[model samples]
Every structure is written in C-alpha cells, then in structure tokens.
Target: MTDDLRLVDVESKHLDDVYRVRSRSFGLLSAGDREEWLSDVQGFIDDGRIVGVVDGDELVAAARIWAFQQWWGGRKVPMGGVAGVVVAPEYRGRGVGSKLMRGVLARSVEHGYPLSALYPATTVIYRHLGYEFAGGRFRYTFPAAELRSLGGKEVSVRRAGPADAKRFLELVGQLHAAARISGPLVWPEDKVAEWLGEENSFCYLAEDGFVVYGWQSGKLRVEELVAGSEATARALWSVVGSGSSISADVEAYMSPDDPAHLLVNKEADKNTVIEHWMLRLLDAPAAISARGFAPGASLEVDLELDDSELAANTGRWHLSVSGGSGSLTPSTSTGEVLRLGSRGLSALYSGTPLATMRRAGLAWGGATAGDGAIDTAFAGATSYMLDYF
Candidate 1:
C-alpha cells in the first residue's frame, strides 16, 4: 500500500479534496465560516504552496508552507512556516505523514529557505523528520483591570492600515533586532495586506511599537503587542485595558519576559500556555552562515552532524564565527566532534542552551574547552514565536 503512494504539488483542482482530508483529520470545520476557511485554503493552493500525498487519485495527506522571514540573533532569516498538516483518517499508521513532511523539507530547500518551523500537533512525526523543539508561542491571560492602572506618559498612536505595511515591517525589524529576538515571523507584503484588511482586527501603530488585537466572545484578544520602548509598552497595554468595563480579561501572545507584566499595578490571575514549535535546518551550511551571532565575539567548533533524511547535512564540518558572522566549511581533520543529529543542531542554532540539550541527550561528545565559546556565540534572548501560522 505504501508503494502506491506518491507525493505531488497540490493544484487548484485538488483544493476541495485537500480540504476534505484536512477537515477529517482535524475534525469538523465550523459551519458558519467554512466558506471563508475554504477560500483561505484555496489561496494557498493557488499560490502553489501546498503539498499532498496521493494514493492513486485520493489526497491522503497534505501540508502548506507559509513564506516567512523569521528573526535570529537580530537578523531576518528566511523561514518556511509549515502548517495544516493533515492525513486521511484511513491513512493513519500507514507512514503517509512522514512522506509528506519529507517532501515539504525538500521543497523548502528548493524555495531557498534555509530554515523551517512548525507548531506540531505531535512531536513524534516531526522529530523523525529532523525537526526539534526550538521555540514556543506563549499565551498569557490576565484580568483587564490589572492592566488599567499601568502608568506611563501616553505616546501618540494612530490606526494602521495597508498604507503602513512598510513602516510596520520596519518597526518590527528594528524592535526585534534591538531585543535580540528569535523565532518571531515577518510576513510577506500580501499577507500584511490581508492582515490589515481583517474586519475584526484592530491595529494601532506608535513610533516605536505596534499592537494588533481583536475581540472574541466579549474577551479582548491581543494577536500581537510589540514594543521597542517601555513607555510604548505601557501605553499600548493600557489601551487594551481601556475596555476593561466591557471585557473581563485579556489574553495576549507575549515574550516570556515582556516588560508589560511589570507595569501592571495589581496582581491578576496569570496563565501561560506554551505551544511548542519545532525547527529544521534545510541547508546546514547556508543556514549557519546566514545566522547572526554575538558582536565582537569569535569561536571555532567542529560538528559531526547525522542527518539520515538529508544526506547533504551528514558528516563533519568546521564552523568559524567572528564579530556576529559565521562560516561553515567541510573539515578533514579529526578532532573532538560535537556529535549531534540534524534536530540537535537545529536546537542549538535557535539558541537552545547547550546545557539543556546536553541534559536532553541531544548533544554530546564535544571538546569541553570550546563549549563556553560555543554557548557565548549562540546565546541571546529566549526564542519565542508570536504568530500561529
């Protein structure tokens, strides 16, 4: 049965079939918004971004790749955000999902994306395909009243529209760079336009920050709240709290150490939900070379990468870093090798501490001398993703 399966690019005609498989795999779609959801899925199909596994004419499994520019060590790195992974119920346990993901990895490299990330429904399948837990989307819930008293001089904020896309992108770039953020995604112009056009979404732009939010069932939901300055953070969060009388609580996607939490005057019930995200390096050399490291720092390390899925990544490599830049070359000399698989390497690339990887058994067999330099070169702020797809 596996021999009969073939992976193919999903075309316009396959949209309905793909949706059926997705609905079945993810459970029933909402009756009211099915058409809107289908339209969104069709857009991905029309863009030639969806891949599917077919068993003779039936779409057995599928996934979509979202073009994104994600930050790493203060630089925007091209990222392929994988989502909508679904397999026909009948195809479960048949290895269809694995094949589909392998195809996605190959296509991502073809598209020139050095890195890829996904919020995984389960870790088993992606882990087998060389993806590792690298970051998370952290959701924080607190009473709106607690934020109302956050005191700060109000900065001027204006409603934002598509006209502000370029400026918005610039602001986000500057903010992420300053914060040394990792895993925050930057959308393409078309996506930015779509986001600005959302009827229910509210967007506010300040000189050094921005906030996008919406309402759901009488609760205020902040889709994103990015502030490059403390004053901006307090002001924007205060705006969210301005609705406290009508909305009981506010839930927002935020960094683990966001400053807005400190501005609140009163303690409220704080709940943090972590949705784990996995990452993969599609092109090991290019991915490493493209990353931005610590400024005025330098180091050298040898790595022995084991990538059964992508043979090009297998073998020993020498990495050199200087002044926030890096280069990777094939190594001939035998030395103390950091023995790791593709997943482990990816985790390290995303700033996952060497100590944690060591405890998790993702890394070992390295010379102890270079470990501190390796850590310093890659270490920065905690990595987190605010976007779901």
Candidate 2:
C-alpha cells in the first residue's frame, strides 16, 4: 500500500479534491473570511506549483510552493518558498507530508533554484526534512527606559499610498539584494492595498527616497525597517521615536548588522527570540552557486547531504568556487570528507557563525573553526523570506 500513498504533481482534475483536502486539513473553508480563504487556495492553483499525496482515487494531502525572485547581493536569486503544507487527519503521521516536501524540493532543483526557504508551521518537523532555523525574530517592547535612546533627531516621515507602491516595491527589492539574504519583500497587489489602507501602518522614505520602510501600531504592534543603507535606515528609525506611548509589542526580525539591531541591544527588555525561516538545500551545488561569493581564490568543499527522498542530493559532492564562480560534482575522492547534518548546514547556509554552532554543541565534523573558506562561504550568506507563501 506504500505505492497507494504516491506523491504526484497536481493536475486540473485534482482541483476539487485538493480543495477539499485543503479545507479539511487547515479548517479554513467555511471559516471566517471565506473570501480570503478561497483566494488563497485559488491563488496557489493559479500559480501552479502545488503537489499532492494521492490515496487511490482520492487526494488526501497537499502542499504548495512558489517560485519567486529573492534578493542576494544586487542579484535576484530564484527561490522556492514552501508553504500551505497540509495533510488530512486520516493521512497525518504516515509520511505523506514528508513525501510531499521531498517532491517539492526536487522540483525546486529541477527548476534551477539554488536555495529553498520556508517559514515552518513547526520547526521540528522540517528539521528531520533537512531544514534548520537560520534566523530569529526578536520581539521586544518599546520600553520607557529605552525611549530616550531612540528618536534623537527629526526624520521627515510621509504616508505611502497607491502612487508610491511601485517605488516601495523597488526599494524593498534593492534592500534585500544588497543584504545578500531574502527579506519578505514580495507582496501581492491585494496585500499591498490592505497595507496601504491600514491607518497606523505607515511608510517612511529616507534621504530623498534613499530607502522606504514600514511600521504598524496597535495590538499587533510591528516595525519593519527596510532601507538601502544603514545610515538611511537609522534616519528612518528616528521617525518612530516621537511615539513615547508605544508600549513594547512584537518587533520582528531587524538585521543584526543594522542600526535597529544596535538600538535593540541598547534597549533590550522582556523579549522573546522566535525562530523564523527554515531552509533546506535542494541541490548543494546549485544552492552554493546561486548566491554571490567572496572575492578570493577558489576553495574546494566537499558537502555530504542527508536527503532520504531525493537521491541526487543525498551523497557526497565536491564543490569548487573561485571568487564565487563554482561547480559542484560528485566526488570520486574516497578521502576523509567534511560532514554536516541538515540543521548544521541550514544554520551555516544562513550565515550563522560557525563558532556559534560549536558553542551550541552542534558539531561539524572534519571541519574546524580555522576553516575560514567553508566558514565564510556558509556564514557570509543571509536570507529573509519577504513574502508570505
């Protein structure tokens, strides 16, 4: 009956079955916001990147992934964002979801994607599937003591509207590209309109449009500081300093290298560090070559990936990169190779310090702290999924 649980590419005939599966799995159908729920499902189908688990003639489980442009060092890297992952109650825990994920990841590689990212519903599930928590969302309060430390200078703040949508999108794209990591930059037209309509949510342009950032006030207190440069980002941050009454709410991931990261440290209060964006390398060779490389000599890296489902990526690969131009090939070298588990690799993929992983007791065998090429190649990268898939 294992073949009965076959994973297949969704087709036109499976729409109704897939819809019913999604409805039963997520409990979104006939729930509040019917229109929104319907739209989400239809949008995924329209985009045509969904995979399903079939049991005989019935579709029992479903997962959705979208291919989009992600920013990486002034270049738009193709990314496979996995989301809407679901399984019916009957099919739950039977490896159906995992099978779906593997299929999707394989498709990502076939489609020439270097990196595949996800904001996981459960981090642990994705871990075994070869995903690791690469980034953290720091939720801090806008405490009174830290108030003075912010907003010292005046920043010309302006409201963003439909007219500014194109520029806002462009600026955000630029910011993500320069950061060498994907930021949640892609927004559908509807989401963009809703964001524009929200009164408390305002966009601030800095340095005569050097950057554009967004902030939201109220129960879901949020601040998204997107900018082209650190100086412009800091200038935009000053605009929010005027609001002293804003109590500590949820503050999402602001880059650790950014001025906001520095200010948050100076004003750290009761905060929770929630992990965001789980990543799995579909093709170690492609993933490495997809991003920009350091300006240096070539270094040979042997990466052993543990993917039970995808046969092509499961073995040892010899990667060669010179100033970032590289090729990955299966190594016939039977010599001792560096071994890294999925979690370690995912952490490494997102620019997490190799030392930090060691400190956390996550071991990378045959590779030492002195291995600067591999370390820099792994840690020099960062990714943010700017879009909700």
Candidate 3:
C-alpha cells in the first residue's frame, strides 16, 4: 500500500485535501478564512510552490516552498522557505513526510535556490535532511511607559502604506549591509506591498527607520522595527510608545543589539520568546559565493563535505575568503580536509563555531589545524532574524 503512494504537484483538485491536512497539523481555518486561504494558496499553485503525496484518490501529506531571499552575512541569497507540512494520522510512522520533503528539496534546487530554511515543528526529521539550527526569531517585551520616555520627536515621521515598500526595502538593505547583519530576509516588492496593506497592521515610516505593528490583547505587537541611527531608533520607539495611553506594554521582534534598546529607559523583562530556525545548503559553492564574509577575515581552507541528499555537493572543495567575500571551488589536489556533512556545513554557514559543531558530534574527521581560520571566516554578528515566515 505504501508503494502506491506518489508525490505530485498540488493543484486545484488537491487543494481541499491539502487544506484538511494543514488544518489537522496546524489548526482549522474558519469559513471566511478558508475562502481567503484558497485565494492565497491559488498564487502558490500558479507558481508551482506546493507539493503533495497522494494515495490513489486521497492526498496523504503536503508541504510548501516560499520563494525568499535571506540575508546572510549582509548578502542576499535565494532561499526556499518550507512550511505547511502535514501528514495523515495513519501515515505518521511511515516515510511519507520524508518522501514529500525530498520532492520539495528537488523543487527548491530546480528553482535555483542555494539555501532553504524552516521553523521546524520538530527537529529530528529536518536534522537528518541536513538542516541545522542556524538562527533565532527573538521576541522581546517592553514596558509601554518606558518606551514612551525615549524621545526623538524632531525627526520626520509619516504614515507609510503600500507605496513605501520599495523605500522600506532600500533602507533595510543599506542598514543590514553596513552593519554586516546576518539572518534577516527580504521580501519582493509585491509581497511587501501586500504586507504593508494588511488590514490589521499600522505602518509608520521615517527617513531611516520603519515599523509595522498592530494591537493585540490590549498591547502593541510589533511585526518589525528596523532603525539605522540613534535618533531614528528613539523616534520609532516613541511612535510605538505613543500608544501607552491605551496599551500597557509592547512586544517586538528585535535584533538583540538594536540601538533602540539603548534609547529605552529600562531593559525589557526576561520573558522573551525565541524560535530557532534551521538551514540547509542546496548548492555549497553557490552558497559560499553568495555569502558575505568578515571584512578583515582572510583564509584558505580545504573541506571535505558529504551531502547525502544532494550528491552534487559531495566532494573535496577549496574555500577562501578575503576582503569581505568568499568562494568555494572543487579541487583535484589532495589537501588538508576538514570533514563534515550538511548539518555541520549549514551551521557553519550561519556562524556556528567549529568547536560547538564538533562537541555536538555534527562535525569531525579531519586535521584540526584549519579550525581557527574556518571559524574566523564564518564568524560575525550572532545569527538572528526579526521575522518568522
């Protein structure tokens, strides 16, 4: 019976079944939400972003790949954001989910994405698929009155709507690159425009900062707030805190080192929610080439990487980084090999320390001489993202 199950492109006929499965895994959509869900999913179907497994007439499992460009070391690399994964209760113990994921990975490669990431419901399956913990989406809560005290009113603030998406991206890009930030993502203009136009969110813009937030449970819920300078940071937080008359507190997804934290009267309380995300390298050389490196980091290290899912990535490769850029090339000459699998490589790609990878048993089997250089090349700002997709 398992042998008869097959993977297929999720189309109009399969949407209902896929919806049911998604509901089972996540939560059921209400009547109006279901219609909107169908409208939303139609875009994915048109773009061939969803894949599913079928058992004759029934769809047993499904997954979706979101087209994204994630910022790694201040550079944008095409990434496939995997989500909406689910399996029927009867199919839990079998290899059905794995089968569906293999198809998703293939589609990701076919679309030319060099990396893929997901917030895993569970880690074991994705770990086996070469995804390792790469970064976190951090949510910090602050006292609304404390934010209200930080004042920078001289800076011009304006209401931003769909028309400001391009400016928003441009400002974000400049800030991320200049800071050499890691683990943020950029949405294409159309999607950002749609997001800015969402019914629930209130969007605000300044010359160097922007914030998208909404009210939830009598508190300000900040979807994102990026500021490039101390003045803008204060101005933006003041804009958020202006709601303190009606709201007691505010919660935001923030870069741990955001300058706005310095402007606040007191630090946010200890109760922060951190959701970890995993990364998988779809094409090793492309990933290396696309990533930004430490400005003064200079090194040449040979690596022996074994990628089980993507055979094209299995081989000895030469890695070199200089002047804030890096490259990976296949080598024929035998060299000092630092051996690891996709998990180690992916973790390292996001700035995980070599010693940590070794301690976790994710990496080993090569000369230790290249360790320092390897770490230096990959190390930078702590990997974190403000958005959860």
Candidate 4:
C-alpha cells in the first residue's frame, strides 16, 4: 500500500525500478539515451545525490539533485539543480512526489547548497515547496545566412575537445564576472569534458572564448557560445552559421540581451522559446552573501519573510547591499516591515522588480517606501541560463 511508502537513497540495483517509473510517468525511455542516462544517474548515486520514494520493492517517485555553482551578480554560489523528477501515474495524486522532493531539498541543504533551482515539468508542486520563478532559458533563432554575415573571417578559430574543458570554464568565469552576468551556471571539469567530447557536437575555441553546437531537427542548435570580445563573438557566430547550406536556421541559448544579438543585423522574432526556471534560497543568508550587487546600489531594507517550506528562512531579516556585495542578517523590525514570501524574495534576488512582485501578490506589507532601492540593489542583466539541467 502507498501508506508504506518510504523515502530512501537509491542504489544501482533499484535502477530498473526507477526507470520503470520514469517511463510510466514521462513516456518510453529510449534505448539511444539510456546508456548515458544510466551513467549520469549512477554518478549522482555515487555522489549521494539521488533520492527516491518506494513502496515495498517499487520506486514510486524519484528526483535527482545536481551540485551546481550558479552565477549571480558576477559571483557563483552553490545551488542544487533539481531535475529528472518522476512519479508513477497511479501514484501521482498521492503525496509521494512531495515526499521525494522534500527529501531531496533536505539533502541539498545538508550538503550546504544555499539555493535550489529547477526547470519544472509542472510548477504547482515546486511552488508549494518554495521555488519561485527566477529566470529563463531562451532559445533565439536566426536565419543561418544572417549570422554568417556578422563577419569574423579575419579571426582564427580552432577545434576544441575534452582537453579544452578547463580553459572553457576559465573563459566563462572571466566573461561572466567582468560583465556581472547573472543566472548562468558553470559545470565541474568532468561534466564540461564530457560535453565537449560528445562527437555529434561541434566544439570550437578562440583566443578568449568557445562555442558548442550540434545539429538538431535539421537546425544548427547552439548549446552554448561564450565570447569575451567582439572579434571572438563574431568568429563563433560565423562558425556556427557556416552550416547554412544544410541548416537554414540557427537556434541558440543566450540572454535576451546577448551581445551576439548586437551583430545579428535585425531583430529575431521567430522560433524563440522561453523556458522559465524556478529558484529558492536554501540558506537565505548564504545566498545573499554570495550574490553580487550593483556596484552603485545602496540599500538597507528589513523584510518580514515567510518560507512555509523551510522554517529556518521564516522570520524578520535585514538585507543590506553595497559595493557590489550583499548581506542578510536576522533583525527585529520596529515598524511594519516589508514582507515577502520565499518566492517573492527569490524573484527579487534574480532582479524581478518590486512593483511587479507586488502586483503578482508575491510581496506585500506597509513598508512600501523601500521598493525602488530594493529593485536597484538587485537589478542588472536579465536572468537566464544556457544549460537545461
């Protein structure tokens, strides 16, 4: 009976059971991607990052947590990237899914992740669990011939592979920090190596940047393209669009305000898809301390925050930001302080304007005077991500 369902660590032997549930919940598990999936899931198991819900011998629900360092205000903070959630259809209406995610969140906090984020299959459950819309993964498309015209033919580009992973990350760190980029993530060396070495992907390296792209549904899809200079940016775009004869269009994961868009000649309005992602603070103080603030921003605000899912986060807090860094401390408020739900604070952390949050009912309280300053403290580039998981 479902009443006997227990939350436990998933092991190698329980994989088939987990896969069965995944198939039932998400559809057929294709053989082509199964080997990679097994290897990836096994790595999570080895790292003690997999959590599951079981009834006797069957896994009724499961979720995987990825240890990721996500960029914010130009710095990276430890974040739990939750993914691959599944609950057998028959068990969906019960509390099993919640149980699995709660266990996962606890594990994430235990591992000292200050934040958690996910590209949701459905927002309701995670919203109930404390995640709020933080940012997006935007795919902007362009005619292949158009990208080709953003010439960098004078610049040199070289083929890159697994060995270039470290350099790739170094470039990313340099670019993101310099630009004060927000909301992208950097993978560990091994994961970066694995992605670079994928045979189907076209990987290239320039003096200051790199690009990874591959064919998908007759289109050249750019998984990631990070460039630190105008020349490198032009070089990468040209290389990806070089496949114009065979692929009429190109799709890339980038910010809505991406530098590449500057050279694209015209507005690209077709085939754009924005996938929203949710985030929450696992350790509110830590999350704030790690985030970079606008260098010119100055703010001192007290928030009466409520996190229904995590008791440690529910209370009054004094948030201060200056000199491109921030701090959050527990404090008593003498007046009706600004109040926010966990979701509201997270949305603000990712630079959502305070006025928008209030209208959406994500925030409230009589302390409305600080809205402009709070918004400025968190404002910068629009939040976005390149990688899906």
For each candidate, the alpha-carbon lDDT, in order, equals 0.84, 0.62, 0.88, 0.89
- TM-score against truth, every candidate: 0.93, 0.78, 0.96, 0.95
TM-score of model 4 (CA atoms): 0.95
Instruction: Tell me the spans in candidate 3 whose CA falls farther than 4 Å from its real position.
Output: none
The candidate scoring highest on lDDT is 4
Residue 18 displacement in candidate 1 (angstroms): 1.5
Clashing residue pairs in candidate 1 are: none
Please provide, for model 2 over 103-216, each residue's C-alpha lDDT reduced to its tens digit, 9 standing for 90 to 100.
787777767776678888776668877788765444544443353355535555565665666666666666555555544445656566566656656666554343223344
What TM-score does candidate 3 get on C-alpha atoms?
0.96
Residues 1-389, candidate 1: write the lDDT tens digits.
Answer: 55789999988778788879877877777876778877877887787778999999877889999888888888888988899999988888889989999999988888899899999988999999989988789888877987766654568878888777787888888878876778788787767868877998888888988888999877898988888878888888878888899987898888877787677654355557899899999988988887888886798778899999989999999999998889889999786788888889899898877878888888998766677888888888778988887
By summed lDDT, the worst window of 10 consecutive residues in model 4 runs over: 262-271
**Local error of candidate 3 at residue 236 (angstroms):** 1.0
